[model samples]
Target: MTQDRPIVIGAGLAGLMTALHLAPMPVLVLARAPLGEAAASAWAQGGVAAAVGPDDDPARHLQDTLAAGDGLCDAAIAARILGAAPDTIAALLRRGVAFDRAGDGRFALGLEAAHSRHRILHAAGDGTGAEIMRALIAAVRRTPSITVLEHTEARRLLVEDGRIRGVLVAGPHGAMTLPAGRVVLASGGIGGLFAHTTNPPQAWGQGLLLAARAGAALADLEFVQFHPTALATGTDPLPLISEAVRGEGALLIDETGSRFLADSPGAELGPRDVVARGIFRHLAAGHQVFLDARQALGDRFAKRFPAIAAACRDAGLDPATQPIPVTPAAHFHMGGVAVDAVGRSSVAGLWACGETASTGLHGANRLASNSLLEAATCACWVAGDVAATPAVRLRPLAEGRLPPLPDPAVVRPILWRHVGLLRDAEGLRAALRALLPLAAGGGPASDPATLGLMLAVAALRREESRGAHARSDFPTHGAGRARRLTLNLAEAMQAAAGLADPVVLRA
Candidate 1:
């Protein structure tokens, strides 16, 4: 409502936190849905990864993160973010987030995949994200300078002379343009592009599309982490069985009760990609895989994981009694619009944080519980950079018709069939062919198709299996030290043009 006020898009953890950090500076937050819904953050069950345990330190936390990233993580960036973990946790506490505590008055720490330390701080058992969001939403509401516009979605970023000028948004009444020099994109990830995912179905990389279309550079588009234990109850957007469940000694067993991952290091607690591939192969072999917590947690399952227990009850099953059926589902994207340490994008006056910005922290694979940490820590820095950057003069904007609302329905099956979990040259090529036309078309599917096209092109060019971007034809890591991949819409479209020729689809 005020002129030159910085605008933050999306009302998720990152966006809300950034606005809160901005303080009395006055900022506007736009939410597509109500404050509590349509955000993957609220559905997050694992908790924040921090070096709060007596046995852990930032150095150990950084080591675990790099190990999980599988050698692609930027050590300096990862170290800086991990170093802020303690302060970030304290910041959350000051905002009224009540983390679960041990009987002795210390923080209740849990373990997750890939981390050697029990450094995860959860609240309300498994409802860590919900609890954090509850605190943040209340904080944002109480802040007098922060204005929240609910039920409004950003349709496009208006960049003039290679700088952000304004945003074209669709609100409850109609479409309108909000002129502002500063815009922060916290619009989340691209999970909904796949047929099955643990993310909110609407979390389909809208931020990426906004950044990509505005010529911001994107990095590591091919690395998508698949959580290995989504509840296999035929839900469109699958409910996640937190890695903390496995951390609590659950075993991955088939219908025959064989521990298929017993021979694998870390077994049920292995890094997500490895565990996901194991389950995927087992499922491909016509075996049903389940998370058997009956022995480890039993009746205690209800107490340790109340939220997950309720989900199990809703599905007509009890985690304490029966082995919960599980399958791999798209969970997180390790890549996004490439940003510097301060979250500034390639385009000036435009910044990105949270799931939308690839700050070289997650790299090829994200360590479990690191996502919430990243969002919480980076949000403060993003707000600082935004506040420090000088405001630019505003120009009058012209009215234009809003683009059709995007639909990922058609893009989901194509990505799942050709680009899901396992990929090869033929499938990648076929995907490019099918997606190129849709991306170039003026239709509701174009935004999703464009993002999918970029991913296909990146996957096709990577040439080897590393982290979550596995290639069946090239099953091993490449010969040299891995480098992060970067691309823009033009580069992606150009690559697609060369590869979109008629190709045989895999049967």
Candidate 2:
């Protein structure tokens, strides 16, 4: 079903948007499973944030994004993406995305943390990501120019002569080399690497690893955004009780029925990192924390957030009657393969967007619901750039064997114990040491194991506390500045080897 153009390595929002924009050029969209199955985009409960509300403006949105980013967001990139919000929203509508609307036909906007205005556009209650994915998948399926290969996994990027040729895929039809003139990596984030996460099990940072292994520069790999209120139901990968629930008037309380976070600067409305830390401290003190929605919200709670309601029911609780137990869980990665204003990675002819690409908009901490906004805007930008570029001849696919996959059970505990919400010099060093053996046992240095090692190394290199990456030993935030780092297998190995006694250097 394919001929030319690039192979999109995922069927998520970014991948579909990239393929749709490159229409008539023949795109092969690879999905590990059927649509809405393995993609994290479908699991998102919060809606995309944009300056779509009547009272909102792009400049205000940009400023909010920058402030939340803590001096790490690229101003030009943020401005460009924010400026395109209305058009991207319109484009989604054109593709049949059913955003919630008021009785008067105006878009219904909801507020989240750090947003000065109500600009969140939702769908069918709290299933904004699912709704957006449904619309995008339908549109992509209807596009004759794009071909979707389901139950297929991209083994590695096919790079030849410093250019991305295609990808090696393994599917029902066995291994095959799918060659294309260009390649777009819309693969999601690295949420699966942690023991507690809100992302689907398949989101193991494969896209980030693939690009990094191929010599693409990665930025801000250390900063991982942990959502503050995942339901503490002992689920292997925790279920998120979205921040939207709090926006609807839910309060964070301890077992004594005391409002714990009320005194915090933003209280129930604080930034994600601050809120996550507050919850973590409560748990550390052996106190049970819960989200109290019954008093203020009552029956309307379940109606507003059905996902949280179902989770509470599954855990033998009722949000309308009792407080729902909650904890911090890995929700979003703010870092990944580095990219520019147009979503172009360090490697030419290769592009990334969404959670897989670190565009610096999220910074050390991501403002709630800003993820969907970033994905939509960046995907649109990448698509336009790809369409404008002249078609080049497809480089012959390279012949290389992929390293075996790493065990999640081992990785989960290491990340959860050491690199979770709070980190320190000793714990991070130990994490590096522990992960090194796992990496060595996997296979050749050219494998995903090595890529995982690179991520760990990157996490170890950043010494000072900032955003989601808090180090008790180096508790103070470094001089407010952002730096980008790119590591290959050798560099990563060197850094990892030195982790036995890490040199705590600040930026």
For each of the candidates, the C-alpha root-mean-square deviation to the true structure, in angstroms, is: 2.3, 2.2
Give the candidate number with the greatest TM-score.
Answer: 1
Q: Per-residue CA lDDT of candidate 2, range 1-507, in tens? A: 334567788888889888888888777889999977888899889898889877899999998888888777778877888888889899899999999998999998988888899988889778999999999988887999898999988887777778777777788867778776577889898888888888887787888878876788888888889899988988867889888888878899999989888989789988889999999999999999999998778999878888878888988998999998999988899888888888888887888989999987888788788888788878877888877767776545545564454346567778788888888767777777777887777543234445556666766677677778888877876664465555556677777876655563222
Tell me how many clashing residue pairs each candidate has: 0, 0
Poorest stretch of ten by lDDT in candidate 2: 443-452
Predicted structure with the largest lDDT when compared to the true one: 1
Give each model a TM-score. 0.98, 0.95
For candidate 2, give the lDDT of residue 464. 75
lDDT of 1 by residue, 1-507 (tens): 337789999888999999999999989999999998899999999999999898999999999999988889999999999999999999999999999999999999999988988999999999999999999999998999999999999999998999999999999889899999999999899999999999999999999999999999999999999999999999989999999999999999999999999999888998899999999999999999999999999999999999899989999999999999999999999999999999999999999999999999998999999999999899999999999998877877886479999998999999998999999989988898899889889799999999999999888878889999899998999877398989899988887888844231211
Task: Provide the overall lDDT of each model, using Cα atoms, as 2-decimal numbers.
Answer: 0.93, 0.81
TM-score of 1: 0.98
When summed lDDT is taken over every stretch of 10 residues in candidate 1, the lowest stretch is 498-507
